[model samples]
Target chain A: MSTYSVSDTTAPAAPRAALTFSNLSGRYGVGLAASLVWLAFGLSCLYWPDLGDWSRTGSLGIGAIVIAAFILFGTFSADYLGSAGQALRKRAPWLLAFGAFVTLWEVATAKFAWLPLPFFPPPQSILEVYTDDLPKLLDSVFASIKLQLGGYIIGATVGFITGVSIGWSQKIGYWVHPVLRFIGPLPATAWLPIAFFTFPSSWSASTFLIALATGFPVTVLTWSGVASVSSAYYDVARTLGAKPSFLVLKVAIPAALPHVFVGLFMGLGSSFAVLVVAEMIGVKAGLGWYLQWAQGWAAYANMYAALIVMSLLCSGAITLLFRTRDRLLVWQKGVVKW
Target chain B: MVVQSAAEAIIYPAVGAELDIDGVSHAFDIDGATLPVLDNVNLSIAPGEFVALLGPSGCGKSTLLRLVAGLEKPRTGSLREDEVRITGPHPSRVVVFQDPTLFPWRSVWDNVALGLEAQGILKTQRHRVDAVIELVGLSSFRNAYPHQLSGGMAQRVALARALVNDPKILVLDEPLGKLDSLTRIAMQAELVALWQRKGFTTLLVTHDVEEALVLANRVIVLSDRPARIKADIAVARPYPRHRGDPYLADLRKQILGLLGLEATW
Candidate 1:
């Protein structure tokens, strides 16, 4: 049995040794192919005459060529280029797919006019929005960040405190649980009409809606986290002469943190939906407002640009939250994989 | 063997406290039905004595240990340590539970430092934490988290955590119950050495009759649930006693018989 088991383990090693050289080349070959695809895309953008007027076609072509050059360089020197080159090499297949997709989009929209004119502007037209409408886009980005941060901070703090209170004390739970049950399930957008009427400004109303959206999940999850802490933990702390405050702050809070992060992730997702909806409905500025304005003016290129920016911002925020969760819950690393 | 040198590095003053369980009875409410656990149990433990409670599983020996630890209140009677009533858990009396119950988030050092930290004396008395961890021979694993430890190592950390408090009485609820036999034997020797060195009134609950005979100076056998004290037999053996000694084997048989099991071996 031992001999058989030893052979079973060594079986995979034989193939691994034989395939090492080819595997390395195969991995880098994907990056090489991806760069060639991007090179073809850039050349097509430069040579293909557009059926419609596209201003930043040259800039788009240059950008694609620059990307192709980077990928080609990275594929050849991945070993020396450290982590960045490794990341580029890893993403080579996706980049190749993206290059193909953009080439098709440009051909259909600009060169051939197969899709439509006003609706599906070429990729260069979206790039034109970035180049031409820089100031307004920058303003919208800042406005959205400020509003979202303010709402998120307020919502997270209040939710955490309320959750701890409800979880700790029966009296608080008795009073708040019913209210939470009543209000928590309703979408924050449903409060749009009343919030606008109640608050002084559309900005404040929008902030309130975002806060409401973020708070419910945070409260519920945090409460559950605190409530579900093993009674044995409390006993251990108490026997060690830990006071009520110490038990809550040190024991309960740290134990409940993983759940709190889950809540934060959920809250952040819901807040994005609320933020965009609120911006579209009433707010004067934000990516959502930019998108609405672009649509109204029949500037589909600008709308696409705003959408790209919105997705990047939302995904970036989630990544940052995950990073923080990873750091705080390092002890829980292998126990629960994100 | 590592514990011998570590034990010499620290010496505890004989601060063992007398425990008095005056007609203590306890019960639990399960599905609105009152279930009796311990029935009018009374025992007096002298200062610095190692006593082990031997019983069948679910015989309320653990419940009695909890009462001594001041983790739970008795339904009908009072428990006292050195003539003072044990109303709630305090640093003077600490417990090592069956599962080792070390906070999963804290490292071994931090877990051991808990009692002092809870008492707000960790900053000044950090050496106590280091000493206890060393005593348990887990100094190398001071920075290691609970999950990273094997069952024995984690149990050692739990012991260190309790010992850091310098408790007047140590309540162990089947502390070595889950360990494998080899590790259990080694830890049993280690526990005896620790108990002798520290001189803390130790109350250990276990179903292992031979274990009770080998470790405790006195073995108290209890009957099944609403556990009544059946017999309290004193093992007048000297330290570094042999496990293969016929005296211990005979006592083990007697205790097992008391627990309603024939010593077939």
Candidate 2:
């Protein structure tokens, strides 16, 4: 409701300054320098011969050149690109650091034969796995995502219901609290041998392990969240003609959302660990299974490629969860900063 | 002074239910010990009357208000509204507590709509929520969250939330106790104006003697813990009562004396 008026006079001057060459030099000089470094490395990959006979050298050079072109375009036309260009310009230092790291990695492994060949494959060798084995890697990625999502949704729903029941009813708490305390602390991986024997398939057993990993934190946090709601909140609702169902659904749940999100975050992290361990030990096909297969064949480049994919997958899942939390808890905008 | 129009009269009804508290007593169990709060209290409030209860600090004033609001049943005796025994909380009687206690996740409009939403009539009576928000002078802040509001503004939203239910009995348990003196004075006048316009049976509990005199037609003073009514005095003053009036100042002195404090000023 509070209106803040910006001076219109200063607005025109900002875009005019952005158009000036001097301003562009100051703002984007570092990014341009970083892009040029990448371009040089890309050019060297095409010209220089390697001691290790790395395939996909041309593909790596092309990828680097494309990235360099993006950065160059982003830096020069930052005003035109709007917020995205500004973001890329800001990441100039990180881009330069990454370029330096890749160059060193390439020099150590393929060029000089240092740091052991099988363990530390050059950047181009990892790129070769992507080009040659794209279909299998994509299948593994899909398997991992499906397995993780199925377990997470099941675990989160059951945990939320159990938590609310425990917090609300004395009889349910009495019955379940002891069991939860006894079984919740043990690692889900500890049950792998039994889970594999009991379940119909390796996939089902892995899912059970993932669910166990995700359920414990969610149950505990949600129980605490529900139990700790202010009595005053209930009083207000009751006096306003709210029934028991209304109190639980409308009053208790919305109030405890911040804590539930915290639980979900913890559960997601633990689920990732369990998912990988389950896949490696029991499941037929997933990123973890792919990693194990790569290691068995001594395809270290494939292993490195899978690791990169795994990190991206995990971070992407976390980002999706955070977006949901942000939308649901919009009223808590100023109270917490992510 | 707010003059109620004929159409507004039909909408608001200007008819409050009579309240009867018959030998009501209340106590809380603290650490396995009985803490008696209200002692043998009996009072009858007429419809459309504004009554203020003044008492010593922690003298079961809020406890009595809670009982009236039906948030808690008395240990003994009965409270009735229009001859119906009060057993539990209902929308017909609503209380505004010392703290606003607005749901932080709800916007001002959503918070005000809570009563209707709970009763499952919000879909049909949506205009009532808007009307109450306008009544509290918070229409401009309808979409704003609780955190965006100032202390006084949040309290107004609380009032609007309670008003949306169209309660016959409005319980006020030191609702302005937390406001600064200037806001408190301004709100006291607003409270009086609202009572005049709505004509609900108002039971206000306050620690401020002048606030009681300024807002209520009748003032009931209570004793310390295990509170007993000491005096019930009528304030025969017109609307826009001045704080500097000699009669009000004399009454403030008498009430302070009854509370075991000297009105030195």
Candidate 3:
């Protein structure tokens, strides 16, 4: 707390100048250098004759603008953004590397045509596909979202309740657990023929397929979570005057939530896989159906575009799940590194 | 049904129940082998008295505390409170274990309010949660989760949780043994202070002789396996008793002698 005067300590060394861009050398300035290279590549793409059927000037111009924006925003507002800005600045080099990759990809496929045909379509072809089929793509996206949500909700809920009941009572567990174990390892897709025959419509059949895929992991993990709850917790709750219901609902369920989240993540992954296959079976309008239609026509560009969308959608669902886990398990804060 | 408020039901400044252990004996079947834990452990604790059950580690001190807490019924005898036999665990008596065992999902305040909520009185007695949190010096961390607390802080939350229920008897099973030395000393003082203020009948099971001497009015020393009361020495000293007092020094020596250990001090 106390500050002491430095009594003219030792001989005063030569005064150093301020830390300016002149002093910032080597890797410290790599981000700026990379951005310049990206800009130069973008400029060349505009003037050079294209070997591809489509002109890539617009998309290349957009990419250059984005890189410029990042450079300007990162340099000027790095102070205002505080820690987030610092993080962005640290990751700037990765963006530069990505830009280099994009430049190489553009040259090889679009301008030079060095890669094989159809298999390696240029970035512009993918962009062209997005521009041409935006409306149909939107429709498929919504359809996929609806199917995934309905199936996931039904599966996760039923799985959670079943898991909790099985975990809570030995009598119920004795009958159900072994049955679940036998059925669990069998692939959900193995039920595809039965599901098609049993359901009245293709919609219901597809939904069942997704649900079956999602439910297994959730049920197994939730069962393990509930079963593994410490007896100490029950004892404490009992001594505190908790009833059977309170012990199960409040104590057991909450204590087992972390495990339940793990199950949800696994379920989400399998559900997506099942969703695609189910759509390919009988579904009319979804990313999976679109992929099938695109492949049948040999519109590889559209297939690539749909694959990107599917990947984004699936990752978005997973990100949402992670956020929910983070929110609910506030007590596990700082214990798990992201 | 007409319900009486907590204030009207519990008599403050002297709320503890008289505990009567009628020749209680208990054992556990460890892999089909009957392991004797306690042997005819007859003891009677007066109302509002502080009694410490002292024995070596693995001597069934915790088992005795559990029995008194009504978590486990004794094999051979009945344990009573205020002339009524204890059938099962009741909120009237609460146990604070050495591990704190605070629920990881709940915040400090919610953990303390658990008993009140269980008894269906939380809606009416919500204010006691803050009061108890403050009592345990966890007011600043009322909303903080259990994982966020230090060992000492977590133990305080456990203490607050037990106290919030206005329990008639407080059974502590070496609650402060896991803490660091400095925290242990501070918590011993805090425990005595709380007992004096709340006037709950305290049955503390501990292995530390100095802790028993410092906290309890009557220290009941027990022998090794199949724990039976070897000596029940009553300390006539008042609250805030001196650690270096000659009387406490002599008592510690005698307790050590009974435990088959030399008085190294």
Q: Write the per-residue lDDT of candidate 3 for residues B1-265, one digit (tens) a residue.
A: 0111232333355678999998989999999999999999889999999999999899999998888788898999989998899999999899999899999988888899999998899998888887777777777688888777899999999998998888899999989989999999998988988788778999998888999999999999998879999999999998798899999999999989998887465
DockQ rank order: 2, 1, 3
Ranking by lDDT: 1, 2, 3
Off by over 4 Å in 3: A1-28, A55-88, A335-338, B1-13, B263-265
Residue A52 in model 3: shift from native, Å? 3.4
| Native contacts recovered, each model | 0.70, 0.67, 0.66
lDDT of model 3 at position B20: 96
- lDDT, candidate 2, residue B2? 20
Q: Which residue window of length 10 is worst by lDDT in model 2 chain A?
A: A1-10
Question: What TM-score goes with each of the models?
Answer: 0.94, 0.95, 0.91
TM-score of chain A of 2: 0.92
Q: Clashing residue pairs, candidate 2?
A: none
Report every candidate's CA lDDT: 0.88, 0.88, 0.84
After TM-score superposition, what is the CA distance of residue B225 in candidate 2 from its true location, in Å? 0.4
Per-residue lDDT for A1-338 in model 3, tens only? 11122355555432443446763454336556656667766765676677757755578667776776677566446556666766776877877787777777778877777887677876778888888889999999999999989999999998998899898989999998888989877877787788888999877888877887788888888999999999989888899998999999889999999989989989998889888888887788799999999999988889999999999999888888888888888778663533
Model 2, range A210-290, lDDT digits (tens) per residue?
888888889988888899999988989999999999999999889988888888999999999999989898888999999
Query: Which candidate gets the maximum DockQ versus the true structure?
Result: 2
Q: Is candidate 1 or candidate 2 better by DockQ?
A: 2
Can you tell me which runs of candidate 1 are displaced by over 4 Å?
Answer: A1-27, A335-338, B2-11, B263-265
Docking class of 1: acceptable
For model 2, the local distance difference test gives: 0.88
